[model samples]
Structures are given as structure tokens and as C-alpha cells.
Target: MYEIIFNLHSFLAYIVLAILGIALINAILGLTGKKDFTLEKDFRISLFALILSHLQLLVGLVLYFVSARGFSAIQEFGMGGLTSAARLLAVEHPFINILALVFITIGWSKHKNLMEASRKFKTIAIFYGIGLLLILSRLPWSQWF
Candidate 1:
């Protein structure tokens, strides 16, 4: 179960990052060109990113409960026993990833309430950009790649 969830989490991370990058670039182009926010493309891209990110969050949550590097590490080590890598997997990665999702959610919600294309683009750019940065910062890059 742990291996399955972990693999799912890892696989989904790539999808989430790709969607986010596409959304971010689209948002930037919309903002810079002062173009209309079309429902067909812009909205769909952002929505896809949002959905993929949420799925990742759910997978990570499950992995946390079942993986030895997750809750079990905390149980066995009592916090101090967690090596830096263990702590990254059990705490930092999950927590920051959730935070990134929150920011993405906020961006999606805020964009819906806005009527102006520029405003919507700005909201997405700021929120999604921040979320992307946070996720990148916490990724177990060394372990993952």
C-alpha cells in the first residue's frame, strides 16, 4: 500500500508540475498581452492544474499514514530519530505541498470572482507562481531524481 501510494504520489507530481507550468505561462501571456481570459483554454488549463494538485494532496495524505518514512518514522523516532531526509518525506514535503495546494485553490477561486482579464491573470500568476515556488522548494529533489 505504501509503495503504491508513494509511486502514485511521485507520478502525479510530474503531472501537477507540467500543468502548473502551462498555466503559469498562459497566465503570463494573458497578463502581458492584455488578452481576454477565454473559458476554453485559460480556464481549462487552470482548472486542470487545480484538479491535479488536489489529487496529489490526497495521495500524499494517504502515503503519510502508511509509509514507514511517514507517520511510522515519527512513531519510532519520536521526532528526533527522523534524519533530515526522513523529516523531508514525513513532514516538510507533505506540509508544504498542502500549502501549495491551498495557494492554487485560492488562485482558482479568486479568478472566478474577477471580471477583468488582467485581474484574473494577475491573481493566477501570483498565487500559482507562489505555490509553484513553494512546491519546488520542498521537493525531495535529491531523492526524487
Candidate 2:
């Protein structure tokens, strides 16, 4: 079960990052070009990104609970006793990813409330962009690759 969930979470991370990056780029282009936020394209891309990210979050939460490198490490070693790699897995990565999701969710909500196309694009650009950056910052590059 742990291995299956771990693999799923790892695989889904790629999809989540790619879609989120595309959504961020699209938002930036829309904002810069002052393009109309079309339902067929802009809305769909943003919605897709949002959905995938939430799905990733759920998978990650399950992985965290079940994986030995996650909460179990913290329990076994205590917070201070953990090595840097252990700390990253047991603490930083999960916390930052959750924060990233919050930013993405806020962006989605704010974009909906705004009537202006530019404002909507800007909201998504800022929030999702930050979220993406946060996720990138804490990624365990050594383990991920």
C-alpha cells in the first residue's frame, strides 16, 4: 500500500507541476496582452490546473500518513534529531506544499469574484505563480529524480 501510494504521488507530481506551469504561463500572457478571459480556453485551463493540484494534494496527504519517511520519521527521531533530508520530507515539504495549495485556492476564488478580465488573469498569475514557486523551492530534487 505504501509503495503504491508513494508511486502514485510521485507520478502525479509531474502532471500537477506541468499543468500548473501551463496555467501560470497562460495567465501571464493574458494579463500582459490584456486578452479577454475566454471560457473555452482561459477558464478551462485554470480550472484544470486547480483540479489537478487538489488531486495531487489529496494523494500527497495519503502518502504522508502512510510513508515511513513522512510522519513516522518525525515520530521516530523527534523533530530536532532529524537530518536535513529527513527534515525536508517530514516537515518542510508537506508544510510548504499545503501553503502552495492555499495560495492556488485563493487565486481561484479571487479570480471568480472579479469582473474584469485583466483582474482575473492578474489574480491567477500572482497566486498560482507564487504557489508554483513555493512548490519548486521545497522539492526534494535528489529524491524526485
Best by lDDT: 2
Q: What would the TM-scores of all predictions be?
A: 0.97, 0.98
lDDT of each: 0.92, 0.95
Q: Tens digit of lDDT per residue, candidate 2, span 1-145?
A: 9889888999999999999999999999999999999999999999999999999999999999888899999899899999999999889999999999999999999999999999999999999999999999999999976
Clashing pairs in 1: none
* Candidate 2 CA-lDDT value: 0.95
RMSD of 1: 0.9
Score candidate 1 by TM-score against the native: 0.97
User: What number of backbone clashes does candidate 1 have, counting pairs of residues 3 or more apart or in separate chains?
Assistant: 0
Candidate 1, lDDT over the whole model: 0.92
Model 1: runs farther than 4 Å from truth? none
By summed lDDT, the worst window of 10 consecutive residues in model 2 runs over: 1-10
Q: Write the per-residue lDDT of candidate 1 for residues 1-145, one digit (tens) a residue.
A: 6678878889998999999999999999999999999999999999999999998898888888888888888999988888899999888988898899899999999999999999999999999999999999999999776
